[model samples]
Target: MHERMIIAGFGGQGVIMAGKLLCIAAMNENKYVSHIPSYGAEMRGGTANCSVVISDKEIGSPTVPKPTIAVVMNTPSLTKFEPMVKPGGLLIYNSSLIDQKPKRTDITVVDVKANDISEAEGSTRAANMAAIGKVLALKPEIASLESVIKALDVAISARNRKHNDINIKVLKAAFAQK
Candidate 1:
């Protein structure tokens, strides 16, 4: 299946990493995937967004104007992307970071306490994985959990084993919870 998704948040929120994980998973699944990151001055404390397109056929444009799903890890992300998602699309928001409810009725909004969940899981920085897990839940076509683990191992390396494990656990837990 073909799907275009946007994962957005602030810098240091692991927004880019989350998008990378999705791209890697899609590659492992042998799907055509393209990842484009949106960068601006607010990267550090500002906005972070990635556009990913997965399709059975060749992708025509790398930029995503209307995504089928938008994973928002912060209030700004939620606010910026919530209105741009296609009607009947899926929106996954880090409820812990965004308290305001999404007003869009055309799309189904799934709000989860991603940050709090990851913090409870002992990886406060893994809120991105929490978001990824939620997205993977809605679309089971993602790479297997095993693939995600391997990718994480490469992403984090052995230097930070404890952090890696915690994030992995968070991702798995999110999968089940989702």
Candidate 2:
């Protein structure tokens, strides 16, 4: 299966980290994957996004002009990426930060309370993991939850590894939402 995903949000939201974790998980499952990250001028509060492609076959390009799944963590990202999802695609939005609802009728939309879920789990920084968990729950073909859990060992730096437990908790919490 081929899955083109876009994870977008403001800086410090772990948009790129989420994409990286997904790639690592797909790689652990022996799937072909590509990750491309983009950042706005400002580091902390500016726009940040990444495109990830996971497939059973080779990927020709990393750019995702039309994504099959779009995970938007903020309203600005929702406005920018909502129209870019392919018809019949999946759109996961962060309900806690985004007050606006998606207007697309052709694609399936899921509102994930990423911030709230992560906060409940202990850290609001792990909202990205929560969002990724929701994505995997909806589309298990993209990557298994076990593989993603294992990926934390590789995705998170050694110094910050102590937070892995909280991240895992956030992931499981979001996954159970399905």
Candidate 3:
């Protein structure tokens, strides 16, 4: 099995962190994984994205030209990566940030209120986790939920560990809603 995914958003939205968590989770499952990140110079509100590939077999490259799944957290990201999702792939976007619906009809589109959910959970920063949870629910074969929880323990920094509980809450809530 193979899954090539792209997670895009403005910097400081945790787009790169989300990709890292996905890769860590895939690694936890003993899958071959690759993560490549790109970002603008600014610390926040600048373009940021990452390409992640998880496969049961050997991975030839880290870059993904056409992703099977695209998770966009902002309008700019949606506009940029929406067209890159393969037909019959999944496009998950943050509805709280994107005002319009995706134009494609061949691929499945999911609008997740990630920011709102994270806000309701008392931490808006965890919107990325909510988005990832939605993807996990939609594609259970990608990685196990337990693996994600474990990845958080390793991927999150020491200063941010306090928010782990709420992040887990947001993830569980999204998974339950799915």
lDDT of 1 at 31: 84
- The 10-residue segment of model 3 with minimum total lDDT is 38-47
Candidate 3 lDDT, tens digit per residue, 1-178?
Answer: 8999999998789999999998999898999999988745532454688999999999998888899999999998898888989999999999988899999999999999999999999997899999999999998888988999999999999999889999999998888775
Error of 2 at 32 (Å): 0.2
Comparing 1 with 3 on TM-score, the higher-scoring candidate is 3
Query: How high is the lDDT of residue 177 in model 3?
Result: 78
lDDT, candidates in the order shown: 0.82, 0.93, 0.90
Worst 10 residues of 1 by lDDT: 38-47
- Arrange candidates by TM-score, highest first: which order? 2, 3, 1
Model 3's lDDT to the true fold? 0.90
Higher lDDT: candidate 2 or 3?
2
lDDT of 2 by residue, 95-137 (tens): 9999999999999999999999999998969999999999989
- Using alpha carbons, what is the TM-score of model 3? 0.95
TM-score of each prediction: 0.91, 0.96, 0.95
Which segments of candidate 1 are over 4 A away from where they belong?
41-45, 157-162
RMSD in Å for candidate 2, one decimal?
1.9
